[model samples]
Target: LDAFLDAEDVLKVEGRLSRSSFPNSFKHPTVIPPGHHVTNLIIAHYHETVKHQGKGFTINEIRSDGYWICGLSRAVATHIRHCVTCRRVRRPVESQRMSDLPVERAEPTRPFTYCGMECFGPFWTKQGRKQEKRYGLLLTCFCSRAIHIEMLEDLSTDTFINGLICFIALRGAELDMNRLNVFLTEKQCDFVMNAPHASHAGGVWERQIRTVRSVLNATLLLSPDHCATMAIVNSRPLTADALDGHNRLEPLTPNHLITMKSTPALPPPGKFEREDLYGRKRWRQVQYLTEQFGSRWKREYLHSITTRQCWHSTKRNLQVGDIVM
Candidate 1:
């Protein structure tokens, strides 16, 4: 260390670059002490000078400006580790572990007992040489994953009420128009409204809307009609494909729960295989198919949802009095 210092009373590094054309600061930089508050402040100044860059850039800036602190890299690193601006700009986003499934999602219940509702599309149809816009209202069963779709003439309240009434008539409901309290009492149901502008709260139906749009887009090339579109969407598989050489039973679908059918597609014409038949009686065959569906659904669908796809690790979430951008 003494060999590198100048003979002057003031301390500076007698670097070998004296003969070079470099600046005087680079030739003999000022030597600063390790672990000093002033050294840290100088590092921090250079840190901001480089716009809060990483350690390597900040160290280069400090050395280029004529200061040579002992253990410079370690000092810069320590200062930046606790730097508020650096943390705010570079820290990973806060996330908590994925939440548990609600009772409506986890429990096996009657189809449509607990359901999500959403409106999508403005499909155009021609009637009497004029084109009219139509919208679809979707009600998805929270348990069975089955869906019921209704087409609305317009977004008007009366039009929506009529469509809703049609849905209730087919799926079932009650009516009481006189008193608000009486209506609420007679309904025996709760309407949960998600917070305004918080669409994440309706993720269930929101995701379903994407699925519906995908199916609609694919089928539009084949048939522009929405009725057929609904049929195709409702027939989509509820579970991932389970087909294998050993497993002959088809993948379960929403149609199985809604209509007790394997698929909306007609079965291919062929002689009935012995393995396909459950019993001699017709009712026995129906009961057997239902039981098969129930068992497969419980084993496959329930298991699939048990594990979180993302956000598996828990992290500290924002608390009260926390500052955010």
Candidate 2:
């Protein structure tokens, strides 16, 4: 008993007797042990003492006061999880998982019929021994995993609108794509705006941004002279085959339209043939690309649906106007 007191300060001096007092809260703080004869009663007392703080705050207070019982965190969490007062005052959040992907995302559809877009970067480049800033806008096709990149000078709304117009014009001519307005109003397409701070909502475009950044970083390191697809298309001179003239990268650029237009993959062993009709082959690649897209999409969607991680069981939630504190 003497050893325990010397070892810890769970009990603090208070006149003739010692009482529970955590350091952070000087207010009437008491530590509750689970095995006490009046364990429930003591918890109820402390809960009221702290004015019904949430599980984390209450647990912190317990720790602060140097009073701990076995499973203290679990006890506080369970207590708050069931507290009617807290439940009523605080809105209960339910994990209402979305009701499956729409047909455009799940079923095979036109490449850009459903797409996700994002803008990132002010990528630094050494131009004539001076650093320059530039931003990239990425458009990811929901169904095909195809990407179109647009370089932007800034993030102004006007700049974005202009980039969109240019992208739309180029794609409109090549793919016979419909207007963005008509696609949503007449074709049942959607243009979703991801809620702020909810990055998961933009997973499609977010992943592509990460991938493009990594690839570009690596490519730049290995081949600083390499030209971007857009640069070549816009007729910038002297683009020496992006991956350093290495034969290892030939497998990724099997078609001229895709090759001349840009790159993919880490290449392979041996020489590979470039398909006839570079311009048409770019569009033709979509034929096989759709199968690969569907296969990958289905595999991922199945994995996502098979598990209920964390909040597997439902608990009784608080009612409206429940007393708190």
Q: Rate the local accuracy (lDDT) of all candidates.
A: 0.72, 0.53
How many steric overlaps does candidate 1 have? 0
lDDT digits (tens) for residues 1-325 of candidate 1: 4425456655888867879999877878999999988887898899999999899999999989998899998888888888889889997766679899888888765567687887877866667687787788888777777777778877776666666667677765522122433443555545565688767667778887787778766764322455576667667777665766685567777767767533322223343434555657665455556556666778888788788887888777788966554
Off by over 4 Å in 2: 1-41, 44-78, 82-98, 173-191, 220-325
RMSD of candidates 1 onward, in order: 6.4, 12.0
Candidate 1 ranges beyond 4 A from true positions: 1-11, 14-19, 33-37, 52-55, 69-92, 123-128, 153-158, 173-186, 195-201, 219-224, 244-247, 260-286
Which prediction has the highest lDDT against the true structure?
1
Instruction: Estimate TM-scores for all models.
Output: 0.75, 0.47
lDDT of 2 by residue, 170-229 (tens): 554222123555544443435556788877667767976876777667654212322363
